[model samples]
Target: MSAGVESLLALLVSRGGGQYGYEPVSQLAHALQTASLAEAAGEGAPLVAAALLHDLGHLVEGSEVERLARGEDDHHELRALRLLKREFGAAVVEPVRLHVQAKRYLCAREPDYLAALSAASRASLAVQGGAMSADEAAAFIRLPQAEAALRLRRYDDCAKNPLAQSPDAGHFLPHLRQAQAETRTAATRPDSPSAQTGATS
Candidate 1:
């Protein structure tokens, strides 16, 4: 892993200090599941890594900072994306920025999407201004990466720890490492189209 991702992993380990909310699940477990699901769904390594570390800004900045950022309506995606961009490059940042909007877009465009959302997502959707209008959703669908964004959303939704279907946290480490390594390779490749597209195309 790159020094940055290694540092991120360490931060996640420490921040998982304990469980919040209602279950025995650790924050680390949640992150692992997110990565695993993204990988399984055929997301590129950067996207899987992005999925895994999407909430790291909250861990690093703490709830108070997060609250302040959110009070300004600033999304966590940007904070995380900025860090990833600085450390990795555009390849890792674009997907992170798009993930949140992917959720919003999916909820607006897909008839059954909202029903699959976790309680947290459902609540956040309201704070995110909920579904988009038909015209807005139609316009969003025209974006080149919209399909990838939708796939990411699908994996994200399935990543939740359903009462009967949660997987072990350790099962995800190998995939996370693999994805991280792939991201590092892709980011450093001189010929990568992502480099030309600023990673968003």
Candidate 2:
């Protein structure tokens, strides 16, 4: 496996028993559950991979999940994006980058969305800049990855069930490998469609 993939698996497995911020489930459980939801929704491989590794920045930050209780943003989404982009394409990295903003976007457009957030999510929302203003929401919606980020945010919110069963990290390793390969291939192929937009390629 590639180093990025190896790091991902190690992080998830090592943090298997650790709590997911203020959620009841462990970090591994939340990651697995998020990926499961994306798979069950018939999302493509890239999206599923994004779901699996979205919070990798938390792993990058080590104990930042604890700092959330103290109101630190930690900027996990941005951190994960930088780390994962080397291995994955924009389809994966962009969603993880925007997932936090997705929460803010949702809070701006969907009247009931904020009410559904867990207490912990609600707290972090404030540190995350709270709901976006109308102008900010309009700008956010125009992002190419905005819709995907919103979908990921939905899966993220619902993946906190402690009793929910999720496949082991091993089950998702192949997809991670595939995503990395796709990214590398796209980046090197100037004639490819992704290359034209300079998005992931």
Candidate 3:
């Protein structure tokens, strides 16, 4: 495995067992459940991998609880995307970056969707800029990977069930490897469009 992949695995192994803020499930359980939901939805490996690591920023920052205690938005999506973009393609990074916005979009567009969020999620939404306005929701959907972000967002919200079960993190090894390989191959292609946009495309 690549050093980047190993590092990610190590972080997850060492720190993913903590509580997911005020959620009912542990961070690892949430990640696994999100990935399981994505896989069951027939998403590609890149998306499943994205689901598996979406909240990695919380771990990377190592202060989700502290930040929430102080009433701050850690902006985990941007942090995780920046860290993962060097080794993972846009298929994984973009969705992570947009998942928060996807929550806002759903609140604006879907009837009663906001009511479904956990209390902690509802609290975070306020610090997350609250629900998007109509125009904001409309424009957000136009972005690349917006749909995927929405799908991942739904999985994220639903994954908090303490009764849920999921596969171990090891099950995602192949997906991470595949995503990293795709990222490296794209970076090597000087003539490829990703060379211009980088992994954020």
Candidate 4:
């Protein structure tokens, strides 16, 4: 496996057992559940990989997360995006990058969506800039990855159920390897339509 894949597996298998902020499930549980949902929804490989690794920044951000509980924004999305863009392409990385913003966008665009968020999600939403302004929401909708990011955001919101059974992290390795392969191959053949990500965030 590539170093990126190896490191991610280690992170998920080792540290992923920790609590995922205020969520009832462990980080690994949430990740597995998220990826499982994406797969069951018939999402493509890149999107499934995006679901699996969206919160990788949490594993990498460690102490910074403490700040979030204290009402600070940790900007974990950017951190993950920087690392992920090196190994995956825009299709994978951008959705992960925008997932948080997706929450804010939904809150602004749909009041019912905000009301439906878990208390923890609502709390973090405030720290994450709360609802977007009408202008901001308009601009956000135009982003190339906006729709994918919104889908990822939906999966993320639902993945926190402690009772939801999810496949083991190992079960998703093939998906990861597949995404990695496509990303590398796409780098060499930039015109290839199957490329999942670009070289930079």
| Predictions in order: lDDT | 0.62, 0.84, 0.85, 0.83
**What are the per-residue Cα lDDT tens digits for candidate 1 across 83-183?**
56535544455566667788888888776888877665676676666788888788877876666666666766665563424344444445455655555
List candidate 3 stretches off by more than 4 Å: 183-185, 188-201
Number of the top lDDT candidate: 3
Give the clash count for model 2.
0
Q: Which stretches of candidate 4 lie over 4 Å from their true place?
A: 184-201
CA RMSD of each candidate after superposition: 5.3, 4.2, 3.4, 4.1
**TM-score of every candidate relative to the true structure:** 0.70, 0.88, 0.89, 0.89
Clashing pairs in 4: 89-197, 89-198, 90-197, 90-198
Estimate candidate 4's alpha-carbon lDDT, on a 0 to 1 scale.
0.83
Residue 191 accuracy (lDDT) in model 3: 49
Ranking by lDDT: 3, 2, 4, 1
Q: Which structure is stronger by TM-score: 1 or 4?
A: 4
lDDT of 2 by residue, 44-115 (tens): 778889999898888776565667767778898887665576577788888999999999999988889999
Which scores higher on TM-score, 2 or 3? 3
Q: 47 in model 2: Cα distance from truth in Å?
A: 0.9
Which wins on TM-score, candidate 1 or candidate 3?
Answer: 3
